[model samples]
Target: MNLAIALTAARYGAATANYTEVQRLLKGPDTGRVCGVRCRDVLTGKEFDVRAKCVINATGPFTDSVRKMDDQEVPNICQPSAGVHIVMPGYYSPDNMGLLDPATSDGRVIFFLPWEKMTIAGTTDSPTDVTSHPIPTEEDINFILSEVRNYLGPDVEVRRGDVLAAWSGIRPLVTNPDSKDTQSLSRNHVVTISDSGLVTIAGGKWTTYRAMARDTIDAAVREHNLQAGSCRTMGLQLEGAQDWSPTLYIRLVQDYGLESEVAQHLASTYGDKAFEVAKIAQVTGKRWPIVGKRLVSEFPYIEAEVVYGVREYARTAVDVISRRTRLAFLNVQAADEALPRIVDIMGKELSWCEQKKKEELETAKTFLYYEMGYKVKTDQLTDRSEISLVPSDIERYKKRFRMFDKDKKGFITILDVQRVLQSVSVQMDENTLHEILNEVDLNKNGQVELNEFLQLMSAIQKGRVSGSRLAVLMKRAEENLRRQAIPVDRSGGGL
Candidate 1:
């Protein structure tokens, strides 16, 4: 939605300064009327001034911070509530269907919806400290999972291992500073003008963004007594909505020889501009497989989108993964694995040096693990694996291990692992099979014993096993089967 707004605004002659921050507001020498803002480019540390007839502060959660620039004594208007969401396997919800529980166990609203080929179960609303990047706490995760289970049948199990990614966002709920209960605060937008002639907007959500903007612009025009025409954005079509159809992907598949999944994804995401992305893929795919190839086998997101995202003002790996694409939100591990290729492609396009590329990867990893809650393997993996295995889990592992141990030698060979993976419909090559053996073979015997298999399953179940071929294979197999049951192609991340 943000991209659509930016694209539409650009086409209509709106100039956007990306990665720029406002230093201070400029005023007239005599009348003290607000004139412009002193701005600094965050990327280069260069400062500049933007002269404008009207200045509107619509920084959402940071509304108070920007308002403070106008007057330090201004009271706060933003009461931010942290809302956390988690993405589970697609089978958790039916395709194109969503469930909304009006009241959770604690009287808050929770929803389970299908999103980007995965199930999105969210949102715990509680007063939180204001921060740019909010982390999803374990307690919130468990609360969501537990609450969601109340709506599902006994046969349908919700496991922590099925969670692909989790994220937290601050809801910019506006209220008087005296209001202590965040839940009771209305989501309606509030528009106000300071004595300094600075217009500010706070609260609201994605569903009412258009109305919020209309109200904001109307207030700005009214407050400044500026000459402007009536708003025509109500009937305005977004940048790519014109001349787009559901069957537009057929043209891409026919002309570019792209896969059905890839075609559908591009068509839905880029709308009429999908052809431009497809052309890049067709032209550059021969030179680099990563350009047209899928980032993960289970999803249809190709590498060309990274190149296209860069062209659309994406400056970092996080922008491409988290914002430009939904890879980071849908699947953190896949996003992490695809990071190097994204940086490599972005480096070539943006003229980044080797050091810049390294810094980008490191910064992106810090975000994925610290901000997004992606787990990394450490020395505690053994202890976590042991703790995750209970009597029932051990028994279940024993029964499954016996099926592969047909010879009853109390151990399974690499071929047995390959067979087990194949039984789950995971295609494995010889190299991957050896890598799996190396991870599970604790004694370096080139074979996995019953105890080793138990420990491996425990770690896999607990999602503590990282950088292991077996863990990735098992996860892929489970997720692929779940997605195959659904009909829609959600790899594009957004509609």
Candidate 2:
């Protein structure tokens, strides 16, 4: 219904039908009641007038602002509450299902919705000023982190780095005049008509939006004395509902080497429209394996998705990441890395200038960094990986690591270290390298920190002892590990 409504509004736009407006409702001359509405388009600075028999103020948190046009004295019964949602990678939850966290530390109900190959959790309610974009605070994030860890196993820790995107929305809830707690407020839709015949609708969830909209349209028709018939949405068939099945997915994996997870993501998100994405992929020869080995975890997204989002749904890099593909919500660094290419693609698609492209990239960065609580883009901070090293230890290792980590990304792949080590008189097998990394990498995130590098170097130095070397090394390493107060499991550590 939301998609249909948005498309319908686009079809009915006043301009060239190509431009969409974020409109502002203005107060016009009134005869003790609203006679007409003056609107200004926020995008193109265009102004227009709509003299309607009735007007519907369906704006969610801004409903009270709209009601002010009719009469500011109308008691603002709609209280806006901020709710935060955190998005992690798809591995956190089942691809086909979601989890309901019945309670949080704050006694708020949380939901883990597996949306578009990302796990969206939280919905902590806190009273906030009606701002343009409400942001989740550090307390909010830590609270969610603690709650998520409570449900996870002992070895699995949902750290701040795991969060890809975080967003907060203002829930327009109907409040009691004397109630102190807005969280206890009713979520039911509230509709009202002022003496000016302006109809205002507010406070409802998505499940009941159809009913809310039906009642709203009905109210508009009755108040305006229109000839429109009763709502036929009861029998409405949603778009892209044709011939969707698991067979299609199986065929995709069989024919295209797509991951079952990727297939599932597309099928659920686009329904029959999965064909369109696949068609693009096939034509461009850009098909990717569902578990993108390149990405470590299967990134069930393809280059073709960039094409689809531009032509079909998105206007900017932010839209592509946040809404169209859900990549930013799945991986923060990946999204940041992809942003420039996405902007370039979108710029060409939309015929954007250099300034517009820069603006789009900045917009995406702002949302990703601040709203989603992803990585701090400008600041160098610790706690990105599961491993920890004090500043002095980090600096010590970083200097030594720069010799091995050619790229200076603080991650030394086998090839990278081999390139440096071969320059010297050092050679090692892949298994040996893996064994060393596995031994020192405490968190098992496939990245070796400075401490790990020191440990590996020390192990290599201790290997010079001849006959008892194997037995002596093991015993000494174990004793050293005990002295250092470190624990080692199979492959050192497992996530």
Candidate 3:
């Protein structure tokens, strides 16, 4: 996405500049028009103002905030919808192509797409009240899992263990007076001319961005009536869009013309500027990728393009990924893998330091997690103690205790203990009974109880327990065991 933006910016001959954030608006006489915008460079603490006859607000989801700059209330016009995706092993599905299920358990469509070697499926739509960072909750995960199981089979279970990555994206929908549901709102865009004459454009999809931009510029041109050059964007090819096929070079007249070569190059990169890229490629001994090469030069070519983007277009890594490249919709792994390299290349070309690079990486990751609804797992150790019980071991003990305490009682009787030990292939011998009685059977009423059984289990599991703690816990387990006690062989018996 950065490459595409840089290439386009270079073609337009626009110089890209960074802004810290809008500090204030420079208003015109009578405060009727926004004559300029003032911002400070977050790093340098330098302030600058951009004077313009007309201003366009392409701030997206934050459109309302920008509107407030003009002292106008636009109401809450942005509605954020969250979508999630789950990654599983390659063999989970065949046919490499993606699958789209219209009927999910939660009433949202499920996309089971082929992403590289792995299969990616997901998406649950939930309303988000907060405009800030949004995250996918446990409920969202369960919702997706239930849908997957329904379509596949009961045997196909998506446990917390199987998840490799999860993510969410916010689709900014226009709020309408007739409908309260965000999903029901139209995907089309709106260009609003505020009373203050601040033009704001909002709500469009990735594929229609060019059309959106063109329309926005046209609206600004008409409103401001400012002197400007013709709208050359229609026929103007972007930077990398040109090229000529090798076969066409064979003809003598065609060779002299060299028209086809230029046409092919433009078709490849600039779409209109194929001849320009071809001319540069020819002189510099650099070749753009043909249809099949998948081109190694493309990366460096893109690096050059990033130079163009940073210099000509107002682009950040976030804008490059979300708007320019449309990579946010691609698989999470591909996006994650490409992000660091992109940041490194951008930083070097843009003269950003390690701190700047770190900031960009963090910002991009946050955008992915909050704005996009993707789950990002960190390597931080929550359970740092090496002496803690193993999760598997804990689970096993829990299962055993639950099985012995039948009738939902909390205690285990002697009979219950004997039956359980027998199932484990252990003999219920006199020595074993004596040991069990000595260790458990608190209150000394000659009856084993749930509290006593639980105390024994806890001591064994921990390898040690305080005598006082045991006495208190055993009392409860004993009562529970008594209520759940079942008849079993009283005489010492073998399993």
lDDT of every model, 2 decimals: 0.78, 0.65, 0.56
Show where candidate 3 strays beyond 4 Å.
43-45, 93-96, 129-133, 153-155, 176-184, 228-239, 244-495
Off by over 4 Å in 1: 176-184, 282-291, 381-495
Where is model 2 more than 4 Å wrong at Cα? 1-5, 8-36, 89-104, 112-118, 176-184, 242-264, 278-297, 377-495
Model 2, residue 392: distance off in Å is 14
Compared with the true structure, what per-residue lDDT tens digits does model 2 show for residues 342-392? 788678778999999899899988888777666453322223222334456
> Candidate 3, 400: how far from true, in Å?
28
1-495, model 1: which lDDT tens digit per residue?
798899899999999878888899888788676788999999999999998888999898999998888889998888899999999988889997899998788998999999887999998999998998899998898899999899899977566656688889999989744456643677888888888888888899999988988998888888888898656679788977897999998888788777888888888888999888887873434533323577767778887888898988999999988998888898887898889988999999999999999999999999998777675434333432343466766776678789988867567876776665555344535654455456665544445777777665554445336555556755553455456552222232210
TM per candidate comes to 0.77, 0.71, 0.54
lDDT rank order: 1, 2, 3
Question: Candidate 3, which ten residues in sequence have the lowest lDDT sum?
Answer: 291-300
Clashes of each: 0, 4, 42
User: Local error of candidate 3 at 183, Å?
Assistant: 12
